[model samples]
Target chain A: MSSASPFHGLSAFPATPANIDGRVDTEALGRLLERLCEAGVASIGLLGSTGIYAYLTREERLRAVKAAVECVAGRIPLIVGAGALRTDHAVGLARDAEAAGADALLLAPVSYTPLTQEEAYEHFLAVAKATKLPVCIYNNPGTTHFTFSRELLQRLSDIETIRAVKMPLPVDGDLPGELAALREKTDLAIGYSGDWGAADALLSGADAWYSVVGGLLPRTTLGLAKAAMAGDVDGARRLDKLFAPLWQTFKAFGSIRVVYMLLEHLSLARAELPRPLLPLKSADRQRVLEIVEPLIALEGGRKS
Target chain B: MSSASPFHGLSAFPATPANIDGRVDTEALGRLLERLCEAGVASIGLLGSTGIYAYLTREERLRAVKAAVECVAGRIPLIVGAGALRTDHAVGLARDAEAAGADALLLAPVSYTPLTQEEAYEHFLAVAKATKLPVCIYNNPGTTHFTFSRELLQRLSDIETIRAVKMPLPVDGDLPGELAALREKTDLAIGYSGDWGAADALLSGADAWYSVVGGLLPRTTLGLAKAAMAGDVDGARRLDKLFAPLWQTFKAFGSIRVVYMLLEHLSLARAELPRPLLPLKSADRQRVLEIVEPLIALEGGRKS
Candidate 1:
């Protein structure tokens, strides 16, 4: 069931920064990517959920992808998010990503109207047709409100260009069993993204761990992934324990918002969430800091 | 809370037809709007949910708006959908809508990450600042996966440029109670989408009836809305019963897909849905045609 895919190891969903006028802050993003590469992050995902892909205009999104790709300078596998409600736009974005030198395209079934699994399939198929770049299905039902069942994923895996999937943790909380079942069903490279159970998922033979924490804390997150990959469950569990409080805050607030605050607190990226989404409230920010400050201190102050 | 807003009566959420290559079929759209105007639809909404605004590029969307406005020629109130996940993009679209001579802007708080009430407030406020055209909030929880509570609506109504809201049918299916409660809370004009409950929602004193059916079957839908507006409950009920089967099919499939089929069935618009969304399956299409054929016959032969 398992097969080698281009996407493996830590695929950091880097948080996108913006200027006060709502333009993508390419300089800041470039610096952020440079830091991630320096800290040993192997792969970088641009315009991901944490990148506020949904919140940027198509032009802004393209700029972010191009800037990230150029700044990374082939140092890492640059996967660009090309998710859109319409297949045409998704295809257009996929072409844009490929032309901008992205190594792969990450897609999600995002809709204002509920879509069936058949719709999701046609979407990825159309996007895959637009570019030769490998496509990674992003299945985050929490935000998408449309879940791709195992059967649908199995069918999608048959599409030649769809080489991987960044999946959400199951709702029923059966992490190991569900992961095992999906692994058994398909040869698509399986990665898990809902940051909370990442350590466990990676330890259970998941090919990649798409990390929100990796965007800002790449060194530490890379350490955790290394431990899990090495089958050092104790080391991975210890890391998860250390990050438990931060993960709790992420659950309470969103990962993007939390990451923005942490980046600002740590003086990494200029902390701003694209509008229609404000930053965490004062009390919530205080709470997050109480959980995050000690861990940042413990990580020896290396921050992107 | 009904006030004399710019939007009133049967507001048609016209489906946008496109060529197989996915470019907006402006000539076809122009012809459709001409037919709609002739059918006595006093208000035309371009790029509403039925129009597949989410599936279009910014340039494409602007072109659609311009084409609709030119075809409408100030004969009816032309409302354009300006919803986007980013406030900046939403603002840009609103400005474009105003520049293209749309009478008002219909917006939905679309997000990949769910937004808080405070965030939705800032989103609308920023858009309002961009243009003088009146803004109508589109609250469709089914697609957006984010529902606006009554409390949030009350707060939103205070924004000066926020003039109306196009609401979804309530979750509990209590149309009258929800309409009554919303009317009590704010003076902002209220309209309803969700094709299944249009008749009842209009009868309950909703200021506007935003209709997918109205775009194609304008004469008949206008009759239903008129019956409800004129306090002819019996007439409205009769129309609802006739349309019940179609609504049922719409619920099972989406209104956009069903309406595309309906428009194509009657030879009105090109019956195509954008990518990722295929046209209905054969069995479902059969079910819809059975429900729609009789009603189409009853409408006295005015086909677009």
Candidate 2:
């Protein structure tokens, strides 16, 4: 795990601010990317699950990638998510991201029909082979619903361009043990999402924190990431405690909803979550405000 | 439920045959629907799960609806699946189905974010309000991953256009009890999918069998459906026994995979299952063939 590797540190996943009609607000998105770059996170995970990649159109996704590529300007690695329900569509998305100048690809087996492991393998193979960019296997079953077996992960690790995996937090909360098992099996750089688990994951020697909050509060999230990565247990726990309230809100109402509300409250963007995904109710939003306001103040009082 | 309701009796869902690019082969699709019409199924579920509704684009889906409406020519009610991950997208799809001449809409709370029951309610309400066509709530947790609470179903049933529900077979397998409980709560016609359980579901007094096998072997499935719905316990069991081997294949391999293989073997269409959904392996296909060939013969052999 090197600093230069996009998979090695705090990889900030920003929501692709889009309208109710699913049109990407490229300017708003560019502002979010700029914040990530300034904060000097390891990478920008654009169009990830938190970014609503599943909800946006390919044309809109391409536009977001192009804007991100321009806005980041080689300051940060832009890992674009290229997940789609159809493998061919994912392949096309990967190619689009590559052609539009993404530094790497993140592909989840975004499935409607539940996929067999072999099908997931073939899907990843097809997409990785379609682009020269390195690919990270997105093993988030919460949204995709396709769980990868260890054997399947080992098989996927053999793909030349597949260099990393973004895994969900293990159910039993055994990061160190899970990391040891995964490390023994495959040489792919391993990272974890589930923002609340970041301190433990990094402290346990995981390579990266794929952070949703990092997208909005990059500097504060980076502070926590650095402390954990440097083996500063006390410092990391202190920062982690600061995030506890926000984490509770994330658990209570999905992290995506919390992040979106924070983005709006910080006045970074006024984007709507694509519908069926509603904004937090007024009461919920007020609760989130109360929880995050102090954290935002500690986060240098919001850039905007 | 009246016989005139598309929710009543056997609703035969058919695969929407398409090229590798997801360009719906409307002519091929028409051929599949024509068979369902000639079989005199109670309704033609043109874009149900087996139809690959989630895989197709809105334009392709609308083309499929137009083709089915023309081909079926009102002989059987045409039920179009108007489900999308986004609520606005679903509303658009519902409007498309209505404008393209679909008789009824099947709305699944197709989710990428796991939806709250209230979110699911709002999604259904928006789509139902968007179209004049009667709507059937598609409660398929297998693909959608959003389970509807009984209360949410009751709430959706109160919406004027929301006329029915297509439920997954209960986990406890107590169809009689589940159906009786649901009947107590709402006037909405209740149906069940899961082809292997269709006999028991219909026999247990479910208003409809949203059958996947009914998509391919309409006559054979109709035989089982008719016997079961008519309260012929012995006759239904006898027909169901004939289907036991086929049902075993469906359970072993997903019904979609088996249905596509059966379609090709019957020479109805040379359509491919969209990528990420690979064709069954040769040995598996051979096994499927061995299981279904006899059933096809019982279906009076292939039409084309």
Candidate 3:
């Protein structure tokens, strides 16, 4: 099932550190990207949900992409998220990412007015035509609220540059069955993104683990990803157990909130999430500290 | 059940016509506002979902507001939609609308990373505090994806300027029960926005009918609203029947899509919905024309 696509294996999604005023803190972002490169994840998913791509201005997003390209320096493939509410805006973002040296573009049907299947298909086609960079269909319904029907996916797959799909974990919890169904419909490379389900997704032969936790603790997460991808069931489960506590916190408070706290705790970045997304309260922060203390040892596996 | 709140009665939500590149077509927008004024809608709901507030940029939104203020010329109370994905952006919109002479503000908890109840509360509180204008909670889950629990509504009602709520129709269809429950919690003037349910919502003694059809055919919609408000069941039902076919189109295709087509068909504006939202196909356009033909005569009761 191995393929040459960059949307394979573990793709680490790092939080973009930015000031309260929405200015990108590129130096801190570079430190995070540099760690992912040294740790040798398959790809870097920059400006993802955890990266607050929706909250940042276009200027800030461009600045972040420019900085990420310089920091990675082709050490790893960089997949930049280019989602916006309007199609033209998204096309502009796709072009900017391509010109700024993004290896691929991850696009979500980010909607305010919920789109019809035809509208979503047309949007993907427009962005796909905008750049030569391969595009991954970002099917994140939890945030974007636009579900991609298989028919729509099949139609989009016909577009030359739509190379992959990043799917949310299936509600039925049958990763193998969902993967089989999706494979029958389209030739696009398939991956799954809920962090707690990463081991199972990989174990069940998903092409990639679009991971949020891997963004902060790249070395530890990559170890788990490798074990599962290699079908070392016991090894993968053992590492999954180490992450069980963090996953509980992630489930309780969203992964975006937990990841920012982790970045600040590790002193990799002292970034504030854009307002409206407040930092965890003191009691919850203390709880996170307690849960993460034992797992700190696992984060020390960087190549440097 | 009635007060002097501008959120009450038939508050017509007109489309803000904009060019394909997201520029506000101020002259076209002024034409729409002027009609709403001549027809004497209770309040003008500018930059609503129909108005494409979520699609327009800040400068464009402010420009739309300035043009609306000049065109409306204080003939009717003006309630402007001030929704944005980020809280700071929403605050800026609210301030801009206030400075540009809006009579009230409609804020929805528009989200990218779905918000916690507390986060939504704080977001609304910040915007409410930022402006002196009265605020209407825009509880539009179909677009914003943030549903308000009654507890959240109760908490928000405690804010002085938070004077009203524009609710979607309840799933149970028991507008009376829902209204009673909401009324028990707060004094916020409660209105409903799903157009097909407008007759029942007003007939149920709800404070307002936030009508989309009213945006274009103000006299006809206002007649229906007046009948329902005055307890003339026969008159309201008769008027509601005239709109039955149009409501069907709204249900089949969204009200936003249908309304944009109507605006262009009527020669009011040659606006294009910002991209990703394509114009209705020819068959759908023909279907709309046939449905609206009998209804055209009903659009002729303007004051001037």
Candidate 4:
């Protein structure tokens, strides 16, 4: 059952494109999904952190999910992020995802209150009860401030619809050891985010790379994941080194801001980020360009 | 003008009690407000962190605010928490709060995407634009995971509607220095939360105590604040010492859970906590009881 999650391999979390007035730009989203599918990425995630789900109203988020499902058109599995601070709202979002034809639901335990493990487990259970779609627990302490303990994760695995887990980079930076420990405890399929640590997690046999970089550089990111998955350690390392500059920009700043900057740099998306979240500063954007421009030239051109 | 903000005093953030089915216990909420007003607390902050605003749906939060306004009956100033992930929704919440007759609004920069200072400013500005009520910036990095910098706070002070700020405990733990510096830069009236640090902050010329304990222990907590505000340093210290044990329990278990437990122990409200956040564990509750029992006795008896 651990190996049975449909969300294995490199999954691209495409940034949600919004118009000047902040409406979801479904036409642009469709184009982005087409590029990802054409690049042979394993799955596509809509409304993840990269998609700015938190900054969109419920109606807008539901609209984006519908558009993503329509655009992906079943070329590959479409995983939709369905997290909210309230359990009832999360359940509502899950049902919406299912109704919109999403293949699976990824949830983060987002809270304004510091959640106890018991509460987080209850949140997942309630949402799972509401939707038949397979659920993937997205553990991102940096953003959500709730780290799902291994024992709790193992407990949650008993829920029939809880099929996978997306882990943050281990706090001690011990990706290999932590992944090994998680694998030992539960049959839950485990993936990892944090673009800086994707190479390490993929090389360490993690099931998926829930990626920000994959959204922009699908072919390149897919190559790296495929190399690591196939045990081509040298190829994976080479790709890691090649992408090091971009990773440095991400680490120095934040992945969300950097990814949005990169998308804007490539002219793939508008520079608009949701309000109360400014775009990367001009100096940081220039620095990122210095890192990415050479790679863009070397790779011939961006897909756009 | 900043010093003239109406939020200067002991403001109790009463927890929003819910029924077995998770509906807001309006009768309990009204009784709690009546108790606080009777005890002569300076203000009432409804739908705050203690109110578990994040766990509530938009409609539920609006309902709670409306009920609180009706209960308070304009007996004292009421500041309602109006925060959301999206600026539009936050503005909507702000409008609802205003329509409900709230005197002011307290907002935390609650975001899934880590916001730049500029983004946070834009968020506040948008909400301020939408409502006539004075806005108090809520800086609880522990929960909201976004801190309002002194520089940004000073900048936001230029917005006429942005009148006050609810600061978290300073990271460096320099209460006097940080508060003085914030005062020097921003004319915004600065208040502080974190019940453990209330004594230091109130004694250091901060204008308000946005208190949790006050909600359940109004007379005793207000006595401490009044003492500090009146420059009775010794009296403030004595109260802080007396409350130290309960504060420690709050730090270890989380204020939300501990406050709910204390409220339950006193029979001030039902023991129900919003889902995904359980009440204090029994052992921790016992430890809290060990610390609080003496104080409860000295207070003569709880309102129950």
Judge candidate 4 at residue B63 and give its lDDT.
81
* Cα lDDT, model 3, residue A131: 96
lDDT of 3 by residue, B1-304 (tens): 1124688899999998888999989999988888887887898899999999999999999999999888874578889999998888999999999898888999999999889999999999999999999999999899999999999999999999999999999999999999999999998999999988989999999999998999999888999999999999999999999999999999988888899988877888878887798888999989998998878777862222
Which whole-number lDDT from 0 to 100 does residue A165 have in model 4? 92
Deviating ranges (above 4 Å) for candidate 3: A1-4, A301-304, B1-4, B301-304
Q: After best superposition, candidate 1 residue B253: deviation in angstroms?
A: 1.6
lDDT of 2 by residue, B115-201 (tens): 998889888988888978899999989899999888988888889989999999899999989998899888899999988898899
Looking at every candidate separately, what fraction of the true A–B Cα contacts under 8 Å does it contain? 0.91, 0.94, 0.89, 0.77
Backbone clashes, each candidate: 2, 0, 0, 2
Task: Write the candidate numbers in order of decreasing TM-score.
Answer: 2, 3, 1, 4
Q: Pick the candidate with the highest TM-score.
A: 2
Which residue pairs overlap in candidate 4's backbone? A119-B276, A276-B119
TM-score of chain B of 3: 0.97
| Superior candidate under TM-score, 2 versus 4 | 2
By lDDT rank, best first, the candidates go 3, 2, 4, 1
Clashes of 4: 2
- What's the C-alpha lDDT at position B33 in model 4? 87
After aligning candidate 3 to the native by TM-score, how far in Å is the CA of B212 from where it should be?
0.6
TM-score of every model versus the real structure: 0.92, 0.98, 0.97, 0.90
